[model samples]
Target: MQGRSIPAPNDWAAQFWSPIVGAEAQATRETVAMYDMTALKRLEVTGPGAAAFLERLCTGKVAKSVGSVTYTLLLDHDGGIRSDITVARLARDRFQVGANGNLDLDWFSRHLPADGTVQVRDITPGTCCIGLWGPLARKVLQPLTDEDFSNEGLKYFRAKRAYIGSVPVTAMRLSYVGELGWELYTTADQGLKLWDTLWQAAKPLGGVIAGRGAFNSLRLEKGYRSFGTDMTYEHDPYEAGVGFAVKLDKDDFIGKAALQRRKSEVRRKLTCLTIDDPHSVVMGKEPVYDGGRAVGYVTSAAYGYTIGKGIAYAWLPAELAVPGTPVRIGYFDQRIEAVVAEEPLFDPTMSRLRG
Candidate 1:
């Protein structure tokens, strides 16, 4: 994503003004910030067997009710993650699928029954998403829609259709950051309009527009897993530390048997690691050492701006995944003092997002 514009249409002004107000910390503490997420493409799936087809392809129980959004993973036949996705049931036979790229349409198509029980349409060119994330997200957004935006009215992980200043939107009560936020989706033509509407609301609420730099830091602080980085097809759900997303008791999905067997034999796990040295920087692929032996490596790393520490996630042997387990992170030639930390170091109780 280097040198690529974030598709913040007509956002040159905000990009220029970020230096003045958006230091990221402001968004985390008091107000809301908008992140351009058009790079993460969306797909539309429809037909008679759309729900059944998805159920067979994912690792979680996909809901068939309209306006419900479910977080599920598409796993390979061997139980390895192919992609992580959020499926929003738009109609009885129609669904909107969100993924990291447009190419996932091919994967969705390839899994379709030869008899044409499902249809996949790539909607990236015509649609886009903007993540309005932070503590004051509701405060900034509630006035634009007649629909309720309160925590009680709109529960987390739910989706609702509403008009935000005349722009059609599908708002999902979800955020990568552990804060009260929403990911709003709209047509590409109206993307800038929606951004401007929210931007105007943010001005008085002390919120500022944040860029991808702040976006990454916010998510890392929340311990949100990055699919390709934190996990790959090489690791199973149990090993990836996202077993909560897998439901084996549901009807048999593609990777059910493999995941069920491996649950009992899980050898490695993904755990958060914090470097005792606050200034130490550990990009991905840094080897972790337990005593003198090499064990696992960091897949995702960033500074926890809120916690005032450097955090990283590594795949370690299950025995070494415990919190407070002493270890050393090899950052370049230097060994930084580190230890295993329980997931979601920033908001373990998740009061902020739920509030």
Candidate 2:
């Protein structure tokens, strides 16, 4: 969100970005964008039972001290992820869990206890989310808000309340782009107004309106997992390279036992591979081979700007999962050679984030 002006979605914004402003237009090697996400819903769980319920339902540790947010996974009893969620602890007893898309209020309501202390609210329409990313994203956003961007405080996985052009907003200092950015959440009625204000402020910093396609490429470059694409209930956390989200040491959670049993039961693991031939593009579920024999399949593939090649995530057998292993990913009818690179194809050192 730097070095370019942010445009207010007027008749122009709705027309420019499509009826859905923040959604994806297409999914390709060069770009990964949002198509549709309303099938999933935004559900808010608050009250005394909120934290305790989330602790039992998710794969990550939700019991942070205060004002903390963490990426988590909702799993079935078998340890397979149902939906990836970002759990934000608003208070000791209140928390907000965000998912990909639609009607999740019903999804969470079905599991809540009949006890009146637990209140489930569907406030999707009342709230809106805008993401600011890119290498210069921080530079763009730093000047627009009055929050402390100090080194020791307000670091990653941290959230702070701030103002954007005088309107109240909750800025979560996180990014799917793997850069130091924030996801600004505010009221829906003022969504367009705030977007324009952010853009106006970020214009001098070179911020541009980041479409979903660009966001896709950014996340793919970071080797970040996408729900239902790279991860699903069919796959466990460990296999998807989301081991950090799962806390095996905890006493109990929905899939604790299953996760423990499958800790070492991984038949394949998530990996990053760069196309040997940049011209040859690989698509999802494309067969991956170790000299003709199928060892795995591409789960998510994209052309990364940072790496200057087609980098992707795949599920490969354990024998060929080590870093520096040679492999081939099939594209069209031909095979595109690749190497088993480390887990984050971009910013592996996390310098972009720390900066």
Candidate 3:
């Protein structure tokens, strides 16, 4: 929202504030890059039944201490993933959910109990979010705020109330781009001030305003899945490569029984593919072939500037999902060669995120 004045084209209804996608992507990796993530949906759930209700709906352990953030999935009765969300426990009976879209709000509303023990509110219209990420993120942010921005002060997956200059904010130490930074959230009225404060601090430190184009490329390089694109209500958590987020040992959830049966019977998986030709780029929805036999289709694709290759994620047979398995992608009139590779190609150890 702060970069709204920048003259650039729109991607996913948000401005491509920076025209050079590769440079923006590089800046996010080398230094700090500010991203306008205000378009993302935000929701607040509170009342006596909030924890119990969310636990019953999400697959991960949700009833944790305040300031704890849990990445979880909302699954259908059939064990299919409906949405992947981050649930931040703000209080014993209050939570701020980073959800997919309006569909998630509708789903949560539809499942509310009639006893009036839980309440869900859409807070996106009144709030704004800015994602500041990179190795220099903490350096640029610590100087402007009195709050401790060190790794020890605010560890990963934690959230706390803090101030940036005169602007009050809720800082969540999480990054979708696999960097060390916080997703700063605040009231819409203070959005401009928050943006100005961050911009002035980061500009001299080589921080740039990144857009969704770079965000997509960076996320793919990190092997982060995008809901509604990389997966949907038709795919299970295991096949979607996010089985780690599901805690079967925890209390029963909506799809626990189905997952218990489906976990060991995974037939297909969302596989990562790297185009053999670094210059051959293909957008999403392309058909994939296993030696002339069409086996699956691409869900998402982007040129990974950091890795210097064209990356694509596709649904393939379990046997073909193995690393080094060769495949081909049908891009218009050409069949480009590709191979299955390990995920999180960039910083699989998560050193950057933990740093």
The lDDT per prediction is 0.80, 0.70, 0.91
lDDT of 1 at 147: 86
Cα lDDT of model 3 by residue, 35-122, tens digit: 9999999999999999999999999998998999999999999999999999999889999999999999999999999999999999
lDDT of 1 by residue, 26-93 (tens): 46555777888888878888999899999988888775568788888888778888888999888889
TM-score per model over all chains: 0.92, 0.85, 0.94
Point out the worst 10-residue segment of candidate 1 by lDDT. 1-10
lDDT of 2 by residue, 187-219 (tens): 778777777777776666544555655566668
Clash list (residue pairs), candidate 1: none
TM-score of 3: 0.94
Q: Number of clashing pairs, model 2?
A: 20
Highest TM-score scorer: 3
Question: Model 2 compared with the native: what TM-score?
Answer: 0.85
> Using lDDT as the measure, what is the rank order of every candidate, best first?
3, 1, 2
What order do you get sorting by TM-score, best first?
3, 1, 2
